[model samples]
Target: MKVTQRAKWRYQQVRQARRQIRYKFKPFKHTRVTRRALAAMVQRVVDQSQRYTLRAHKTRQDEYKIVINGWPDAVQVTVGVHSLSFLVMQHADFCDFLLWPDCMPRRKHGQWRCFDTGCLASGPYHRLEDLLFNHLAEPFLEFLTKVPEQAQLMLYDMEGMHHACVEAVKPLKRLDRPEHPVVCWPLPAGSDIV
Candidate 1:
């Protein structure tokens, strides 16, 4: 029987993951804690985060950016108002998504006054998942697969939202640019759940 290199590599990866899970989780098993205590700890962690949602109607049509973390290299991609126009910067980054401009068009007389969809529909914005898969997926997977996961992947946008959780997925009306963009963060255990 012959084993291909890919199969051998996968087997090794599975073994490594099991070993890491056992070693890392051992501490939690030894420590005895009540349900109330566990709840308190979770609450504390939730309190540390500033929670908010990024709205699709609020995103800038003129600009779209995605920031990836856990990579050794600094990576950022931005798509401007023009079609097929984009900028990729290495190592230049921002933690707050609120700093970006609000490109959401205002409604005037029941009609949207801003050109939000046109710009976003153009350029490389549509290929977001693809771009990340090509350039950043390896490192991201490595980060996820590593032992004692310490790094977190976050998405930020112009709406001052951070640690967003997606509650729904829907399609856009026209241009099919994107739809139902929402962001949410974990709240305290007993607090209002998003």
Candidate 2:
């Protein structure tokens, strides 16, 4: 077989092996101490963020912006209410599921409120995961991967969300209008998750 084909086969074999290992030791890594420790670290890291002004005025999406870490260039991305914590949960896919305690959304009288921390009281949220995987995450990843060089995605979702953790960066355009970030949060009508 060709070298490229052989490499592909090897990659598949490695992926399968990893999946099996994860399935076997799935019960581990779930502990209160571990969760608190992780959260504390992430909170400290986020506190170090250099405040960047809100670019040209836009809606809440663009109005609230915090640039993600690890970009050599000054390409700014909108930091949705809980983007950091959300990214953390996404990255912790190594485990069965991420226990994000403070990522609850509160909707009161038809308004979606952003919760940075604390137990939220919201109801009738038919599309909870949809909002993240579809509205926020897809566009965020799209913008993150367009850079010339690979950048690191720091996630900050521990017990109470006190520390930021660096996550993976893959090349996949999940957004359409990279030039227009204000409209990127919602992504397109048929936005998808890879």
Candidate 3:
């Protein structure tokens, strides 16, 4: 093959690889294992009572599962307090947690778009910031303050991850919902959580 032709082919291959890479739904903050573990924990909390879905890194770096129990298959879960509690941990996993799309958003230009951004950021499942920064800190705390005491939450690493989770959920405690103390098992440091 000609050298120029070979270069062109290589370029195409690289682009294709990137496209494929971006399609995968791996949340940046928590490892794949972390997502899986959380899913299992949530399942245990609610059990398989309702016909629900669990999509780890459903689109990107935000792990979320919409669990709905008690229903007529029609009028059930509301997108407010339940979701607020449900995503308490998930919101902490990534900088931006998108509740919309079934997939995570890929990068556009230089930044990621996210569901929480109100279209300020683009997202099917995009990010507001990199996983680390968001994991370390984010703007979700205010929402956490509004939660009720009976809300059911599952924490994997409370002490270690508490800095992020607590801060993120703090604001939600003030939201209109009951708080449900959780059974937390902090992940061992450096373990391959995913």
Candidate 4:
């Protein structure tokens, strides 16, 4: 083959390889082994006193099955869960703890989008945990203030990701919703959340 032809062939191969790498793995697809592995990894990291329990979903294996249950405060709440994927591509990880409140609406099956600025928290794994905690702390605490002591909270993590965009807010007369206690921290216009 001519030198130019050989070079062209190599370039095509490289392009195909790049494309395959880009789309090869869909991490959100939940398999039995993947769920078990995730549960074990999370158990290893969480504190023993936390008594975090891993509950597997009988169905919806494609979504996150194991939920990390623990108390962030006096209120017994779910700290977070191990899920695959992220809203932004910058800080994508093999697994992430999508914290409560943020993880609340995310668990529902429907069209999901992030209108809040603090959707994607970027940093190292530990720092990412801190960010997740900070994002959820206020809302969860307020929820505890309203929730009756006898009531139980089940923390479940779902594995579905959607890109976030800016949004305009309307007037709010009521701020309390027993089912939804989410507090959104809006990003400044054209803010860099990478």
lDDT by candidate, in order shown: 0.30, 0.35, 0.33, 0.34
> Considering summed lDDT, which 10 consecutive residues are worst modelled in model 1?
49-58
Q: In candidate 4, where is summed lDDT lowest over 10 consecutive residues?
A: 185-194
Task: Give candidate 2 regions above 4 Å deviation.
Answer: 1-63, 80-125, 146-194
Give per-residue CA lDDT, model 2, range 133-171, as digits (tens).
Answer: 333344444443342222243333233333332234432
Residue 157 shift from truth in candidate 2, angstroms: 39
* Alpha-carbon shift of residue 143 in model 1 (angstroms): 20
Model 4 / residue 152 / CA error / Å: 9.7
**lDDT (10s digit) by residue, model 4, range 1-194:** 99999999999999999887783223343456445544443343332212223333333433332332332221212333332321212234312222245521121132222234456633223322333333444443333234333223222112333222222452133523533222333222211121
Whole-structure CA lDDT of model 4: 0.34
lDDT of 1 by residue, 10-29 (tens): 89999999887773112212
TM-score-best of 1 and 3: 3
Alpha-carbon runs more than 4 Å astray in model 4: 1-4, 16-77, 81-100, 103-126, 148-194
User: Residue 178 CA error for candidate 4 (Å)?
Assistant: 25
Candidate achieving higher lDDT, 1 or 4? 4
lDDT tens string, model 3, 1-194? 99999999999999999988783334435546434534453333233222222222233343433333221121111121112222323333422221212213333454443433433433322333332113211222222233233333333333334322322133334332334323322221111112
